[model samples]
Target: MEVKQNNLIKSLRIQPLIVVIRLENNFFNISDKRENLLLKIEKLSNCGIKNIEIGWDSNPEWVNLILQIKKKFKSINIGVASITSRQSLDSIRSLDINYSMSPYFNKEIHLKAIKYNQLVIPGISNIENFKEAINLGYKIVKIYPASKLGVKFINELQGFKKKDMFFIGAGGIKSKNLKSLLKLGYDALVIGKELRNQKPDKDLKIWLKNC
Candidate 1:
């Protein structure tokens, strides 16, 4: 299904927590690793996580796994991240992913996703990149390395030019500061490392209850 921007906006407005799983480079090491990851996704889904982005790697096996999950789950929005090359697009085209995410604000990638009728979100690291993305008609954007940029930087942009702009805070965001970042006006939060490393199901239950 081709996901529209308005539909994505509505979904985000209702559920703003985006769990980003950075697939370990050594994911294939464990036996039944594919099932393990899918089980993790099931736990997250049962906890009411409506959105998830598989980031960090874009291997074919991972792409196939996404397709399999998408077929089984009817409610979740599955997205593939780190789409920077045409080869990446071709590799996962059959997956029919709900959306695409990038770690950089590249016009080529953005346009390519659009051409494929997919909702695309670009990551912006600075005011300049943010401006360029907004000018290109991207309403939803991810603020990468939020920890480095600090809450003060976000507060300063409260009166941004684009009133409809929505920001997803990612990179170095942990359980300790997730609530604070959400309160600071980040439309959504992308969590990793801290939330998924040990006992993700237990952590997600506690974290989401507070949200």
Candidate 2:
């Protein structure tokens, strides 16, 4: 049988929008609020967003929720982000996850993820880490805490990079500024905490369209 392509990278080739759903205390409440979470994802899907990140917060049960989402939305590329250790990769790998991302660059962690044949996107900020990631053949990377770095930094980095490395703008991303970042040529955006709104269905619909 032919092996399938990694969904995260495949989705990027299709579009550059990603909705990051953080499984925080909400994971504990998923049993009761499952439909609401599903609805939020459904709204994003309907709006043409096909990639999502399930922010891992040290909760093992969170993988179960990811499995559920994958089963329900076969076309959506679901990945676990905020990874820091080999253990996190192991857990996600056990679930047959095809993609993952970390908040910072770590050679060991990157190697381990590669060993699992996972499409690993490491966080990059300054020139040094970005160079190292590219040296390791990472074509796509995440610009984390982008709110702190601001749009100017991203513009400057994109202007000076060796190759056209795709960037996923994450950390403190909001619906208001998402379009501006996209206009600035960010390859993708990962919206998390701020997305858990009282009106997720309406908000997601608008946000996805705005992007």
Cα distance off (Å), candidate 2, residue 179: 2.1
C-alpha RMSD (angstroms) for model 2 = 3.3
**Residue range 62-179, candidate 1, lDDT tens digits:** 6666767788777898887777777776666777666667877888877777777666688887778777777777788888878888887677555564787788887887766666
Q: Alpha carbon lDDT of residue 172, candidate 2?
A: 85
Report the poorest 10 consecutive residues by lDDT, candidate 1: 196-205
Error of 1 at 55 (Å): 2.8
Best by the TM-score measure: 1
All-Cα superposition RMSD per candidate:
2.6, 3.3
Clashing pairs in 2: none
Once fitted onto the true fold, the runs of candidate 2 whose alpha carbons sit more than 4 angstroms away are 1-10, 198-207
Q: Model 1 has how many clashing residue pairs? A: 0
Per-prediction TM-score to the true structure, in the order listed: 0.86, 0.83
Scanning candidate 2 in windows of ten residues, the lowest lDDT window is 1-10
lDDT of 1: 0.73
Put down candidate 2 lDDT per residue, 81-194, tens digits, no spaces.
778987777778767766678988998988777777766688887878888887777777899878888887888778767565678888888766766778887877887776
TM-score of 1: 0.86
